[model samples]
Target chain A: MAELVTPAERRRLFTLLSPAYLWLLVAVFLPLSAMLFFSFLTDMPQDAPDWGVTLGNYAEFLTNPTYSTLLAKSLKLAVTVTFFCVLIGYPCALVLAKSIKGRSREALFLMVILPFWSNSLVRIFSWAIVLRGNGVLERAINFVLPFDVRLNLMFTTDAVVIGLVHSYLPYVILTLYLALQAVDDDLIDAARSMGASKLTILRRILLPLSLPGLLAGAVLVFVPVVGSFMEPRILGGRMGTYYGTVIEDQFVAVYNWPLGAALSFILLAVVIVILAAASPVLKRAQT
Target chain B: MSRVDVANVTKKFGQAVALDDVSITFEDGGFFALLGPSGSGKTTLLRTIAGFYFPEAGTIRIGEQNVETVPVEKRDIGMMFQNYALFPNMSVADNVGFGLRVRKTPAAEEKRRIAEALELVQLGAMANRKPSQLSGGQRQRVALARAIVTNPRVLLLDEPLSALDKTLRVDMQIELKRIQREIGITTIFVTHDQEEALTLSDRIGILKAGRIVQAGPPREVYDRPIDAFAAGFLGEANWLPEAALSGLSLPGSPGGRRFATRPEMLSISAEAPGEGRNAVKGRLQQRVFAGAMATCLVDVAGQQWKLVARDRDIPELPGGGEVWLSWDPADTLAVPA
Candidate 1:
């Protein structure tokens, strides 16, 4: 349907596109290119006089079982956190988008996204205060209950998941809310008129229609959680050693830039593969 | 297969009365239309019967079952929305078979019934296609197929044909009537277009301000509207001025009564009509020439009266000249002002 562009029009189009392309080049491609190049080196050139470019960092990843084990562990943690976020977020989104109306919906939506206003570290530390042993959650439970109980929840995998879910819950809720809001209420009514029960309508009508947004939210939560190091480090304590933390150590503590870059590239490859597997369903959802 | 009756139904949203003690019976296998303007509660009545909204005080019966407290899914009703809400994820066949599948019909029976419904709508070949791939009229046929496949006791249509183009709307109106006859399910449809109601319905109920003003056979309601609102809403009514009714033996007590005649009933002539006919002298203001028909606007005693007649039947007249509008006394409709 597009007509052939004149040369002057092509020049204008190029002028319009240059700024965004230039920003992508400077901000994304350049850094990725540097990392790819550094991933093949044996050592940093400035740190060692006998510096050479080699495949030693990638070879070390293949030889060391510890790297693969930690990578698996990080992927498991990502799946767990994404699962909980979806489990808690989808119903909240449905209630907010469909059941509530007018000004109250707006107010509730504001409350849902209110966590994004504060810094991530501040939110994570707040969770630490509530989830710590003998903290606010424990004190509240004790005051309400007849017997006392020890709640030693600090510096654990559950603590890390709680902090991460608190930080990333809004992303799922926001995406699912937009998708659920876009669904026509009349469609649900039509299904009901056909004698479809509530469960049948949810299974046959709502879920398939909103699959795109659900996948988008899951990917948004999954990618960051896979590469997360700060939350696990702050709340996971001795159990905080993941592939991301090990990659962080190579850059900051160990000063092994080549190994860190190689590990980061591997994580990127895994994420890309997961996305590639889900792209077919996402493409079908568009129609 | 069933007659639907609403008895003293009153539905309110907050303080606004949507349906005020409305009662109407949709007879078995009858095609009924609820005709009204926007905000006139025609759709509200349709939805109330569909069990989408329960009335605050009423008893609704479908066949022998009391259904005022029933949910839409349990009411055994088929409702086609204004927008033809076919599921985007399902094929035409699946959309048609949704209710059957919900009822846990056997797979072979479901397939047979889906094919049968599609065939009824003449969309048998489009079974595998998605609703989005079909054209507007095709999608309408698919919605019809889906609604009827379940063999629901009642069919509720909310302006289903309003979305189609003029030619297609006429074609689908005939198709809808034929399908409804073949199935013989009680149907209640809501529409604002008076012509569509007259063309498609066996009986018409005219609503104004959530009350049924007039309901009867199409010709009866068209010929004898109970009030001015019903008369005006159902068709164009040309008021016969009080001065013009001076010497005529008007129907009913002429005290608080006003008379009106249908546009097509009045004949325009240069001279007064013969005996037993009512005639009024008026100045011809404008004549609009449409194909096959024409409209003459006449000023009768400081009021504009419209007369519609066949273009060939109307004679050429001098511009702004005197004309007489005449009609039989039987054509005079009396309504309280």
Candidate 2:
């Protein structure tokens, strides 16, 4: 191996790493620090000269029941969407990684991830075209059944969840496919050769072995969905006024950037806590 | 204990014939080895017997039950994979107890059996350790313990000792034989290593091109191979040209085929023996001194013959010089042309 670091090499190392680190500082850390500062203020500095530091933005969240309710709604939506994505994606990944072979597996994996090639918001809008009152979904359901059916799912929470699941399902499957592919086929054979049932093999071998990837995919989906405002607004219509939309309103419509920053800071704190709690179990599952 | 019988078993993967009408029988409580070169269907036969790959055209019977349609899980068998395949997440005790748990054995009996199995492998003290925490040899032992804890009717080992270093492998061979003997389980071991097959098995079946070429005890297969393939596969076979058998008659019919004998059975000297023994005069082609033993390649009538002896027993002889090689005719064997 070559030596990775030296006193004279430090200049070259700094040159190689500075571009990415500087981009992160300018693009992420600076904005986050500015948001943290603004979250403790009474108003945006551009709005008035008398603006000063205040805890009123955070206190509004505690005193008003609506913000907490909307936050809970957003969190619940994230949980439901993550659950559906995992439930549907894991088996698809298993079939891709284990059952299919060679060229066909690669083709099918590409098909599964094909949705990710397009913009996610476009996909959500496409779902709106399919799930409207007199749309393709209702017609298809009616065609399958012997009776007429109306699927006015455009403004429902179910529509929002369906769109979100479609958006994130590929991520879960990709993680799980790589993880499942790494598991030795001989281990499954060893288990089956010992009189283990199919369910036993899945519960004890596949699930435990793939848990880390599963949790990673879930966290990735959950974090984005918690802060998502576009998909719900596009698909849920009047029913889409969750915590994310309230924050969006504060920034763009109400001109209350401080309150939006306060809400964004609280959500970030929640995400960090969730990640910290799950890290230990995730670490064990990896091995 | 159970006897496993594979009768006229044929298996094909799409257009490729992996096993072609292979037939063999493993005796009750006998340690049997399926020996062959890679892609010779030795592993296919072993996996078929273990119920992993069902044969296309024949029956596999464990004891008295024909298990052609039986899935691997329903078959009463234990198999150790080539890589050991110890569950990385489970403790040693948990891995051993897995089979018992699958069988729905009572907790108390499962515990006792797991302990007994671990003790049999001499890994009882490391029950709580994960497989990752153990050495390669220890991981192999844990895999063995896990396989046998359920007391299945047949034990299948798929090149189980190939991963170990030579010293550890020899020790494990003895350990494996002891455990199998103690349990009195019918064992079928698959290996391409002929010495491992000869050393470990009570009965050996030699396979080629997905068919059984010969099946017999180790000595029978080595000393009386049915063909040149078997003779050369199990060990070295020094072939004697037809011209060398002119006046010297061998014990067997010779059947107008090549004759061969193990190198160890031949003796080299500066002078021919004054008796009715098979003797030939040749120039020593090359002498190789491997530790403790030496081999001389002798060219007799343009045919190369080999003779092995102890390093000290090989009298001082010039390399590429004239020598006389002799062996008892009874030690002679004939191979198919």
Candidate 3:
């Protein structure tokens, strides 16, 4: 039997949770509030003397084609990376969870996740070195083939995609592996005994069953990739003028802190909408 | 309907043998049960027949075709799992209609067959409900409907009723037998429950350590089991005392073989020296009374003999006091030691 939760018990719970919630309040809510306030202003208070609350920061985004174009490009980039991650990572996760057995599965699973544990910046840099023109990747290809070929992928949109895919693939694999593992083996056997073809089993049973986890992993990759700046800065080089880098330019280079705050708030709004849309699917996958 | 023949089937998992050179047949439209203790390979044989497993050595003939190397999907069989294995995402009608859909049955025909199958199982009203919304017995009916909707040659049931409570299990048992008889599909059931096997199957094959111990009708196997394991496994038994054989053995009893009698066959007597009946004197160890029937535990010489009779027929005997037990010579059964 449990004791009734009285006002004193409620106070105790609040005390226990206050430290973590208070940290979130100071670290997340306060900064978001400050950004909202700044987005409404004409200029940063620290630099301009004649600063006043204005809608010009948002109006600039509406009028300027460059910011909206780059935002569309960033959204497209996030979609491409999420597609590849789910495509390649889902099969890898299926093999890890179902085909592999015992000790080697553990070792292989750890190897798949080993990349995310390392510095993401370092991994992106490594991709830059391997994919650059006349680099190790080209040299290896030349050694294998009889003809010389230029594999100049660095500083291109392709380079940014490659780098981002490498960084986010492992996390999605982990999510999908947990989902595929939960699918009962007997269900597969039952399907087989019913004369369902392999493709039919995967389509009718496996896909429907594991959709929630797959969607969850897709969301995880998409949200981060949309706001990604450092990867594009390093890998995209001259080609990497995404919405994130533009937002960065406002804060660091252009000194338009008010505009950056408004753009950041818009990105947050998009992320919330995406999560709200996928919540129904995620909830269905659980049962 | 097809008469399935499994000839000399052997299966192994690593070095451990799960089935060893086993052979059994199912008469077309006959209900058969594979009964055994756990780890006795009854379920393994059922799975092999269902084509979930391929034997290392054997020829499995379903009617006229050899299905030893054939894949499961092409084998054309319907199986009900221990948990019923109904697709939770689909409604009852859809779940039952899944196999028909896979076979590309037309919409109208599929609907008619699905409706007929559900009607056969008496679940026509619950066709739109999900399996989760149904009770245990209802889910069982749904599984049966799904398995039979395709009209597979044989139906394989893996402990389908073990999930239900006692009263429900008995009710489902009758329902299952009636449905099987009505459909006339060759059915093979797997269970470790001996009484369930006896009550349900027209014939039973008792397995032990991957081999068949006995195969016969329920009454034949229960009354005249070829060995001690068969006799003991099917039901209870009390071995006739060898030391007091000449004294207690009637003149007309079968000679030169070990004898045993069922607990229920023996009767309790207050007086000794019966003329034509087999009789023995023993001390009353305990009396277990349940309604009109009661069982008395008696110690004769060094062995304990059990006698079950009517509560009124069992005389009031003090514990550790002598009591006479009797049975006819014809009731004495010979069994291997």
Best by DockQ: 1
Per-residue error for B198 in candidate 2, Å, reads 0.7
Pull out the clashing pairs in model 3. none
lDDT of candidate 3 at residue A7, scale 0 to 100:
91
Q: lDDT of model 3 at residue A76?
A: 98
- TM value for model 2: 0.94
Model 2: CA > 4 A from native:
A1-20, A40-51, B242-247, B251-255, B270-275, B279-286, B297-306, B322-324
Assess every candidate by TM-score: 0.97, 0.94, 0.91
Lowest-sum lDDT 10-residue window in model 1 chain A: A1-10
Candidate models: Cα lDDT each: 0.92, 0.90, 0.88
State which candidate, 1 or 2, has the greater TM-score.
1
What local lDDT does model 2 show for residue B22?
Answer: 79
> Which stretches of candidate 1 lie above 4 Å from their native place?
A1-3, A45-50
What class would a CAPRI assessor give candidate 3's docking?
Answer: medium
Residue lDDT tens for model 1, B159-258: 9999999999999999999999999999999999999999999999999888898899999998888889988999999987777778775787778988
* CAPRI docking class of candidate 1: high
Higher-scoring candidate on DockQ, 1 or 3: 1
DockQ for model 2 equals 0.76
Tens-place lDDT per residue, model 3, A27-120, is 9999989999999999888888999999888888889988888888999999999999999998999899878999999999888988978897
- DockQ for every model, please: 0.84, 0.76, 0.65
Candidate number of the best lDDT:
1
Evaluated at residue B174, the lDDT of candidate 3 is: 97
